[model samples]
Target: MSPTLSPSPFGTAKTLVLKVGSAVLTNADGDLDKGMLRTIADWTSERMAAGCNVILVTSGAVAAGRSALGVRDRNLTISQKQALAAVGQSRLMQIYAELFATHGFHVGQMLLTAGDMEDRRRYVNARYTLEELLRRRCIPIINENDTVTVDELKFGDNDGLAARVAVKMQADALVLLSDVDGVFSANPKTTPDARLIEVIEKVTPALIEQLCPTSQTGSLVGSGGMLSKLRAARLATSAGTHVAIANGKRPGILSNLVAGKFVGTYFPPAPTHRSQRTQWILHGRVSGTRQVVVDDGARDALLHRHKSLLPAGILRVVGTFKAGDLVDIVDSAGRLLGRGIVNYSSAEMDLIRGHRSADIAKILGAKPYDEAIHRDNLALFEEVTSAR
Candidate 1:
């Protein structure tokens, strides 16, 4: 029997990260909605005054920049989008500053990339900075370092970043403010009969499959869609942080969520808490290019058997990566199994693939470990064995 779903306890949330998306922050004309921004700031400040630590993860820089530049090309070049982010980030921060100042709140801008989270030292530094900001009673407004991130190092969407931040800060809850009311049985825009899913007890493979086939498209200005929010929720929930997806335009949405009002789709955290290292291993947001493919036997051993991946199980090494680098573990059919720190470099993996563990030293004259990925360094998801 399946466990019953329950609403997340937002009222009990002491540390919160509110992620406001670009679609909700911008008007139909792609201009930043100053009024809505101010409203959110007022709500956030009220919470902070009540002794709650609120960190905001916002997305509207590109949209704001496009409006500021009067450029209408929706399909922008990589460099063009970076340029837009560079110009619009300053404008967005200025607006946040002015609006937050109205409520006597000081906002500090924090831009981060996925690479920063991968590096243990940098991750610690970033965490300390955020802690210091909260200690000083300053709200940290985080966004992707869009100006400098290339395709290789980008977090892709602020939703993913917000989830990572929530885990890093050990936040009690993550509220994603979107244009929609909440997650529905289907895409509400497409399915007229779609019903809202008020509570999600678990983020499973089946749930994700039901979301949408249509690429999770965002506002005319944003890159993320509803799917991204669900992904973020999964990341946070694994770390025992509750999550909510609600409409940013809804009146008093922020306060209402904190009041435990039914304003959005709430996802409860997992019963067992995941360690910080495990969270990073599972949801470090490793790109597709870094995935490694293994055989069905390897997949079974890792999932049902709970054993480490041996060299003989590796079917194919997908990308260039060194030992200690995080890589996705996928099956022969390219379905993602999980993610882990690779024990062997890609070049070395190629030489040892499909070879017996005992043959490792014979082939390369060096064998760092018997397992290609040790169980200690690995984190598995439900998708590892879920029906494709």
Candidate 2:
């Protein structure tokens, strides 16, 4: 039987990150929706005055630029979209500055990409920058660097960005503000009787496949869909951050959320809590297609004994990856054990698997310490096989 979902008692989340979608940021003419922006700014200011930290992950730079250029090219190439974002980003920030200024608030613009979140050094630097902004009572407004983010331009959205940021910052709650109120049992447009799922206990592979059958496109200006939001929710919640998918169009939605009013579908954070570094390892991007499958003994050591992965327990190495890169560690059955920075490359791993630590120098003619993945660099996931 499926587990019943219930909302956790999250009393006035102190640190909040809000992801406002392109639909809410732009109007019908593919332009920036200043009125809506002002409304959001107003409530957000009120929340700030009440001593709540709010960081905005916004969308609509592309649409803003296209509207300014009067370019109605629906079939825009990746280069074209990048050009548009380059033009619109400044204009978008300018407007955000003006609106936020009226409430005696300052907004800091941060243009990020997927690559920034993958490299540990870059990720740490970005977090420090964000922390400094918040320390000065400045609202950090973040968006994808679409002008140069080739991968993101293909299909990524701020929804994914927001999730990554929330986990990195260890935010108390992440509110995804979009056109729709929340995730539904089915597509509301086609399935008239489809009910809104008010609470999601856990997001599993089966649940995602059941609801998001065909990807639903966003507004004329945006590209993200409900599927993206669900994925975002899953990522954030796994890192022990509460998530809510609420309607941006709903009047006083921000105020309602601050007041603890029921506004959207809620996803309670999972029980396990992790340190900041652990959060990064769990969510950090894998460098290559490489996966190191460990034997049963290795899996036991990682999951229960809290030991670093050893070359002796590795059954086989798959794909190619260099040392110091992030890679997935899996069991022989293809179940993910964890992910971490590898101390050995796939080429080296091939020769070292099932070998004794003392034999490393004999085989490779050198040694670079022991342990394929050190415990300090590894992070176990919330979901893992039960201990035998």
Candidate 3:
């Protein structure tokens, strides 16, 4: 649904997952945005008064660390970044506590790693903790655990994290507050004819290929780009959560979206929600013991037809895995297609690559099934990315 400057766009959202990117939290000078932080605290309190529950996912700890340590270089190594996050997280929370406390509300901190959301038990525990925090009229402020998260554990940006939280919490809406206004056909700064796409009913790979090539990852202070936000939208909207991407730098942008003022790009939720297992399979760290590389035909079948992955489409397997383990499916170009449980071991798949499904028994002398990965066990992203 498109908002026409009316209050109906997000007016009915009882619980909202709001993510503030580093672009809004860190100033151009790489310092904390004092004024913006204060404004958001007040805005959040006001929303609560009107009976809206908000789960705030934020980014800025590393930037805060940079400011405290007086380091301006953006090329810091993984270890350096972790060290800075360790120092800055405390300061960031302190500032937030003071700001929110002034409004007669308390705040709770939640530092999460990719593993927290990927594991079922940890995910449920996190949700229960958040529920209690909100029940006590406190805001839950969440951030990725950057201090010890390196390599595959890192979220790279908070956009994906917010979407995962929104899905897990079954939030009514999600607002991504960033520096940009919304999604566009191309880079508006460079393309004279680029136009804003106000309503995105569904995010598709074709749309991504058309609009995302020129998207810059982020400014020095932020880690996500237009493509990242779009990918996040694809994940959330597919799982029955509404989403909006707006310019947080603009005054009252969040309120405008909440009030249905039509200030950003909006995506309506899917007609039906996917099963919990589907959500778990689709939205994790995008991990598997290995990535199963597929031919173009196989990628098409999995993505477009929702068909089973067959031995005919297999190209090469990138990692080792036992049967019944999740494995990433990628095209030859290394773009992520999806992930699913593999019926055959990595060694078995390597032997059967590029062969017909009917020949599986002849080649291996044992055929568990004709399909390598069944459609029921696979989940494909509507938009493709080089994320993993």
Candidate 4:
């Protein structure tokens, strides 16, 4: 029986980012699935003809390269995986180039690491490059730079990478093509009664608990699972980009999905905020240098008054860090207010803590900026919590 296709909210998106996992692009025997790749390319070309911009974020190089190298080891070392990625990235892009070209569409490959997106200058450069590609009528096929990525610089999975790309390009929607049809109330394979959730308005903790019990393990060929997809959904939605998680194995799935036909789980966008810096501050995985606690008055001034974080409001600085590092801003009760880039080093902040902004010169002997965290660089937690 054909699964029922309902209206999708993605019908209106002008620019879309579509991500396909390793499992979707690989066969059970672990070779690249040429048929599936062709289908996706065809659909993407058609979408482009209809005046919609499409960026394809894909994962399969490691799986494909490993197969070509005749390595059957399930657990390969980081170096081995990197070797596979180095080898397979080219082969994968070759296939994409050939297939997309067959349909009269050009493809541009972009390899990136999480660090590239975290750095402000690199982030801007990437965004401009993608925009220019789209303007030139070329589809940008992106993948993680797995060959050189280490733990600190890794996005861990393409799910998070796709979300960041969507936000960076100001895409209207993000489509995640995976092995599953959608997010089920329970594991569909183990539980016959598991219900497929059609639309998710919010990724609440309760919903996560109900759908994801233990962390979901990906298919034999992919690293991303349900948990990573959910995290991606949260990030994309928070940035006002709608997201859809659907079965990639289905024929013409991308076309059907954007045609207002229900395919997989859909996550609606949050309130639109055009501030890209704010989105970066909210979702960028730059490890914070320290925790800065503020009193209720400071919290109100930051949130309601839309003011910069002044030294007067800082209660304390918790750790050692240099200037220009990310820091967490919390309230007296330990509630997370948001995150921002601090202008002063932890040592300097310690000296200026609780002092008025005017006294910064007297204390640190030099002040780069009056605000501890400028309003432009600050982002508030999107979740609503009662004032303590």
Candidate 1's residue-wise lDDT over 1-388, tens digit each? 1122234356567899999988789888888899888887888888889888999998888877888999887877888988988899999999999888888888898999888888667877999999999999998999898888776223257888899999999999989998888888877886799888888889875677677455555555567777778888988998999898999888877767766775578888898877998888887756448877999898888888889999999888888988889999888887778899998999999999999999999998987799899999998875554442
- Estimate TM-scores for all models: 0.89, 0.90, 0.81, 0.89
Off by over 4 Å in 2: 1-11, 214-220, 386-388
RMSD of candidate 4 to the truth, in angstroms, is 2.9
What clash pairs does model 1 have? none
Task: Write one digit per residue (lDDT tens) for candidate 2, span 68-177.
Answer: 89998778999999999999999989888998999899999999987788888899899999999988999899999999887677766688889999988888999899
What's the CA RMSD of model 1 in angstroms?
A: 3.5
Global fold similarity of model 3 (TM-score): 0.81
Residue runs of model 4 more than 4 Å from their true location after superposition: 1-12, 152-155, 271-274, 288-290, 295-297, 315-321, 385-388
The candidate with the higher TM-score, 2 or 3, is 2
| Per-model CA lDDT versus the true structure | 0.83, 0.83, 0.82, 0.83
Q: Would you list the rank order by TM-score, best first?
A: 2, 1, 4, 3
lDDT of 4 by residue, 11-82 (tens): 567999999998899888888899988888888898888888999999988987987899888887788888
The better candidate by TM-score, 2 or 4, is 2
